[model samples]
Target: MGKLSNCLSMIQILMARPKVKIDDLAAELGVKPRMIRVYRDELEKAGIYIESVRGVNGGYSLDRRSILPIRNFNSTEVQELQIAIKSYLSKQPDHDSTLDNALEKIKAAQRDQALSSKHFYFANDYLINAEVGNESEHYKRLYHAFNHRKKVMITYEAASTNAVTKRTIHPYAFVVYDENIYCVAYCEQKEALRTFKIIRIHDVVLVDQSFYLPENFDIRKQFPHLGFIREPQEVELIIDTPFSNQVKESIYSTDQIIEELPDNAIRFKATLNGEQSIKKWILGMGTKARVIAPEHLKKEIQLEVEQMLQNFQK
Candidate 1:
């Protein structure tokens, strides 16, 4: 196995077992006992504190206190970590080079210093697939700005007003919300921290201005709503067997309650964000799903369907 795969495997083995002998680890990694010692040094540099017992029952054990929150991640969650890192690097034009450089550094930093959450994640297979497009060049520029605590000037096109405006912002961080990449920055125009979708930024340039991320600043704390777009609204959808899994796995899958209905149907209820988003999803399901509540949303869907039928007939 490659170095990184071996590192992750070593972590998994140590996490699962109480103690493992050096010979055992050497055999598991298909390397000499000398190389096992080298792996031990690498893991130690990464802040994985392995304690060696020098006795007849000698073996290696992880220091519980030295474990970062990554120790809490299972194999599935490890995959999520890969996606998160990939998305960050993909936003840069020189992604391949950036990813290689980042991985080398990641092998050394636990990232516990950068983390705000005591428990960094929850069990959800939902993967991040953000689209960066040609804006990746600017994204690359602004990405460094956030990293270095530098301010940036951006010509932004507002999604709500469709107005283009220029603003100087102190960038806190870049985050992916609802598969859309956003720069959570302190906007000088509004004098407030706001979420700006990276795609809507028409132009961006780094300013010579430097700033600090507020001691209390946290992206999750700023925007913790389950619904990814607009505001959340209550809705219930009754779906047949064929459509059940799709609704549960949807992008707006927030605060969901699923109950089995008679004759192989599922009742799925959720307080989801984005009225238009949910309408489009239900429409896509067609005969497989039906709305059970919210008369206004049902009426909106009916009108939307009517407009679609008119377009089809023309």
Candidate 2:
């Protein structure tokens, strides 16, 4: 190996073993013991400092944190990227050479990285950019079913009645809304398309049977309001100070508007999809939020508060 190759090899050795003897590093790289010390000096100049221990049992070790900037993709991650790219291309009628080239480049880079370095790559599921936070096993199964046009048997809990039922569903696509994960699927039990929360799904089993997705089926057209697939309502709220700032940062609806009050509060207005989800949000804000418009919603909040007081008194 050349000078640069010997330096990288020495660093790799230090990473794998804690306190590698200078003689061992030289033997591994087919270089002199003195050359190992030279490699350490070169590495230190490149901001990768090796810690040298003293006495008989002493050797050199590299801090793992310092070398973490090296970017490398594992097999699972590379495969997931390729799958996403293909999924995207499948939707487009025209052939996109750009995305195809990108996939090839990613694969080439993965192979090159594997040959150059011995990295401890984890085969974990790639997190989908959704409000679901970390990707779960349920997400992976649903994604697989969606991609393959297969049906899945899921044990689901209903948010309204807390009813649990086992049903088979043909998942259409994954939708992220209101900091949550939802799957738009055709429910076999209901014989209609329904949106389900991924978290509420307790278990998922992939079925062998495959289904065909309708070419004209568009998720956006079907669920114009997304998760809040209900009667649309024009809602208004008076949010106080710090809490108002929080509300301003997020768009509850596409047509949302905000106005600043003299007292530093905010008057928020939006054409939200339904009253149920919006009511829950107002209640969650506690004393900092109050409903201004929609008399029915205000009365409901008042009623809920009264019920809470009565329960506490009992």
Candidate 3:
């Protein structure tokens, strides 16, 4: 890449991340650590101030405001760009607040050129911009643990029960589902892998302990439903018409099997994690959906209905 393009790329990287090491820049730019020093000097000359830290955990960063150059995109590139932006924003580090501005800029570009606006941004319905801190310091620390494969201690508030607890975890991966961010980690207390919503996480601190991830620890293979559970359980549901008939085809998990029943309903079966999530989905559907097998889930739903009815009567 040309020097000017390289400099801009470096600036963008620094802006997106809290800090980056010279080694990282070198690898990305196909250069040497010494070349990073030269680029830093060049950036300084261009009125871009990059703060450098020296030590074992040292790197460079900048907080100055800089406008990204806009480019015209072809039809295919526009679609790809929208997808790229949505993907990035959906899984951005918790400390990343500039994503909103970046998305706004993309929207502006689309509006200026009269491009289609639909699907340019993640649908708000699917995502909760549920940030725990305004400055996102927790996200930053969590990222540190993830990047270095370190153990981290965290205080987490449960989304279902609102119960709060503390645990130490070996940070593994960050998964994005329906535009929401979740951290998948091995919880020391649970002795298993669990997914924690980013919004429910707080007080994340590196435990000064390192960990080696398992050899087959692929995030996608390990987490099909955003890391909610490490294991998948068989789930069978009966969808009543006209919702069942309205569903044109299988749209949920790729492994889901949908069969048209003789009674004009649909039978849906899939191995999934997160019983609570499925329960909530079923409850949301009201009378339109019912659990078939797994008698325990049916009873759980029955009790939930009873409780709701009792509450309404009160």
Candidate 4:
């Protein structure tokens, strides 16, 4: 961490708790106790003050009300910020050094405050076989086009058809769905809001042409399922033993209900998002889990299994 980063971290530590020992601060920041005093002096010079406690177990404390101008984030908030940084960096081919530096500072402070971190992650296994090229450059171009209200010409390979074609698009905003980054843009060819997976875009050219975004255009409202608005479907499942326990550990939906069954099985019911995601989860569990309701979903899973059997037989 740099000087500014260290100073910010020191402030974070002070604000989080009543006091921290000088030696503890030094150990957390990987510096000497004497340097801790130097940092204190530097911070006091900038109108933030730390009070010294005189005695054994003596340390430093900050009056949060006095430093109200500086925004102090709790441990949970810091963790959430880290998750956002991870999501953004995951899309780029190379790490964003600026965000990485910021993450380091936050981590230092997190350690200093003895804050327990809760991991928040998004799935990305769908991208394992993806064609990765100069993704960083493509991302930058698309971002620039979005920011400047300019159009972009992209050679995109359709995931469904595996057909590559060029199209002019008015970039709107970046959308992350099912652990993939997509550009929510107005496709001139489609004449509607469409999502193009970032990794699927093989070529990008920023066009000088300018376009205006509709003032009333809200991406979430336009594409309900992509964002906060999800049309969840009711699902019932019988999951055996450890898989049931594993499912119990996670909250698929706020209204989810679970019932203990004989032989350590569970009857689980939840209004989860989309049949596709639910179908995938059931298929992943194999014979350990079986769908109990939404008869159509049950038939679909049966069809999938039958196809798998056919493949194996062949």
Identify the runs in model 3 with alpha carbons over 4 angstroms from their true place. 1-171, 176-182, 185-200, 205-217, 222-232, 245-251, 262-264
Full-model lDDT for every candidate = 0.66, 0.70, 0.65, 0.70
Best by TM-score: 1
Residue 126's lDDT in candidate 1: 28
For candidate 3, write residues 1-314 as lDDT tens digits: 87778888898898899889999988988888898888888987755668899898889897453232433433334433444554443344232346546655655544333323211222221122334222356655775676677999999999889989999998776554443556678999999888877778867878988988775666656654443445456778899876575433324455778888877888888766555556665676689889886788899999999999999999
Q: How many collisions per candidate?
A: 0, 0, 0, 0
Candidate 3 scores a C-alpha RMSD against the true structure in Å of: 14.6
Question: lDDT by residue for model 2 over 124-243, one digit each (tens)?
Answer: 111122324334678778877876789999999999999999999998765544434577888999998888888899999999999977766665556554445455778888998766
Q: Which residue pairs collide, candidate 2?
A: none
| Candidate 4's TM-score | 0.51
Q: What tens-digit string does per-residue lDDT give for candidate 4 at 9-74?
A: 999998887899999999989889998899999887766778899889789998553464433654
**Ten-residue stretch with the least lDDT total in model 3:** 117-126
Error of 3 at 268 (Å): 1.5
Better of 1 and 4 by lDDT: 4
* TM-score, cand. 3: 0.43
On lDDT, the stronger of 1 and 3 is 1
